[model samples]
Target: MEHPIPSRILVFGGTGYIGKYLVQASVSMAHPTLVYARPSSPLTPPANLKLRDRFRSIGVTIIEGTLEEHEKLVSTMKVVDVVISALPYPKVLDQLKIIDAIVVAGNIKRFVPSDFGCEEDRISALPPFEAVLEKKRKVRRAVEEAGIPFTYISGNCCGAYFVNLLLHPHEKSRDDVVVYGTGEAKAVFNHEEDVAQSTIRAAVDPRARNRLVVCRPLKNAISQLDLLSLWEKKTGRSFEKRFLPDEELVRLSNTLPDPENIPVSILHAIFVRGGTVGFELGKDDIEASEFYPDLKFATVDDILEVFLRPGAPEPYRGNFK
Candidate 1:
């Protein structure tokens, strides 16, 4: 919890889009870092990847392994002071196995589980998002039961990943900002760098242990209209916003029988519910402005440049849906 972590920091799922950034950030520091991957994950090792690479470069102790192997997880974790898990949401609940192994292996002062989205810690309840929250809760409980020092982190937005997943302009209607229900509901978002920095803070801060940290970029809140305004300003184009009425959206969604297609109504409920204000950044994330005074984050305009503006960026080059 001092100037930096003790050393030998390990990252699970270190080859993901964000995971690569985390490893890049950590390996640049004057401490040892290790990465755990299955050697077959979708993220291929970049060209000329190497342990000597630093922030945005190739640098990390790339250990090929699987989280399913309890013995290997324990063995690798045994040598590290902290663990930053960047695995997918799908593998979150299974992290119980990893936590169990860490507790058994011991000497682990901290663990940063892979929570890189809306602040479940601050959001009083989970609705459509319950399935995602359920996994996070299970992993937290596993860590608590194991008596391991932990930092439960909720970030603004996972930067590129979320934008890529959620925002997709209709191909035919290029000027419309498509959203669920009224676009008035707000949810705060932070860049991947911001999340990574807060994670590093949580990893080393002994005082931050056993805490639920919600973080975001330092700024005033904005609504979907405001977002579209920013897009208009950035792209110099006229755009119309299409709002989906709540009831009709629900009826349309209910027609789909599968849970996979349960409907946008459910997801809309989670977003509009009282608890999830787009402005949410736990006290610490808001306070991070002081520690890293120059920290910069992408804004609505920046997102629009690649997402909406005509000829701003290639169709295939954007990060969002």
Candidate 2:
């Protein structure tokens, strides 16, 4: 942590589930954090945000604007040193416009793009994946071209992946975990809280000064089927799941080079083939989950039990930005 403390952060998408946590955490770190909550539109409530008493307690400055909402962005960036973006993964390019606005204003010392799902940098023109990676690459290039100090926080799947889709006890589908092959491909999967901590680490430590900084926790990895199995153990239910045959999955995967409607097709693809990248690293200075600090990870069992289980008590409730 070279810098004593970088102050004044502008967090794009601060009303998101993870964004609210980052906002509260940033405020706790005593950084003057401003949230880019859209000004014209009414913000929708982000379920896991508003409930935190600390969230309410934090003296967070809310800036209502988008990247195109230049006037507002400039005004807010005038005082901030770092900008941590938590916008949707697909919108990484649009977020670049925000980065441009920040640099144009002559302030932002560092920028954290909303790239917390798999190492997009490592992905290639594999069927269905080419286009998404292109967008991510474009945004990264924009930062490099602009000479903006940046950190591409790489994480596997979000807590939502386990808690919402595949292994939750209360899945919309009661099917045995749908998997690719035997589902033994391990990859980095960081919890939202850990990712936020990595963001903070990137924010605080000048040493993490790479054009792309990664903060993965120690042994914070799992496989597609094992993850489901972990959930099965926790929920004590054998899932009625089906495994997509490799040939069929690969054939289906062929349609993904440039998905027709990206978001929709991507969903279809994941459900069809089931996906994995098989990467895990030593705690890369991005590990900070006091909620279960002792445990290396939430495990499919631990996270869903808390975040995904129906009627589980949530921490904050900021609306989606």
Q: Find the candidate with the highest lDDT and give its number.
A: 1
Candidate 2 per-residue lDDT, tens place, 1-321, comes to: 232564788888777766766786677567777777655433454442343334445677665565677777777778788888887655667876787687778877888777665456654434455566677778877888888877776655566544455554454466566665555655445666656755665675576654444534445556676677776776666777677555655566565343433533333333333332433334443333332243254554456567544675344322112
Per-candidate Cα lDDT values, in order, are 0.62, 0.60
* Tens-digit per-residue lDDT, 102-193, candidate 1: 88898898898887655555554323355666677778777888898988776654544434434543243565656555766665555666
Candidate 1 yields a Cα-based lDDT of 0.62
Q: How many backbone clashes can be found in candidate 1?
A: 9
- Model 2 poorest ten-residue lDDT run: 312-321
Candidate 2, position 190, lDDT: 60
Candidate 1 ranges beyond 4 A from true positions: 1-6, 41-57, 124-128, 162-173, 218-220, 248-271, 278-299, 302-321
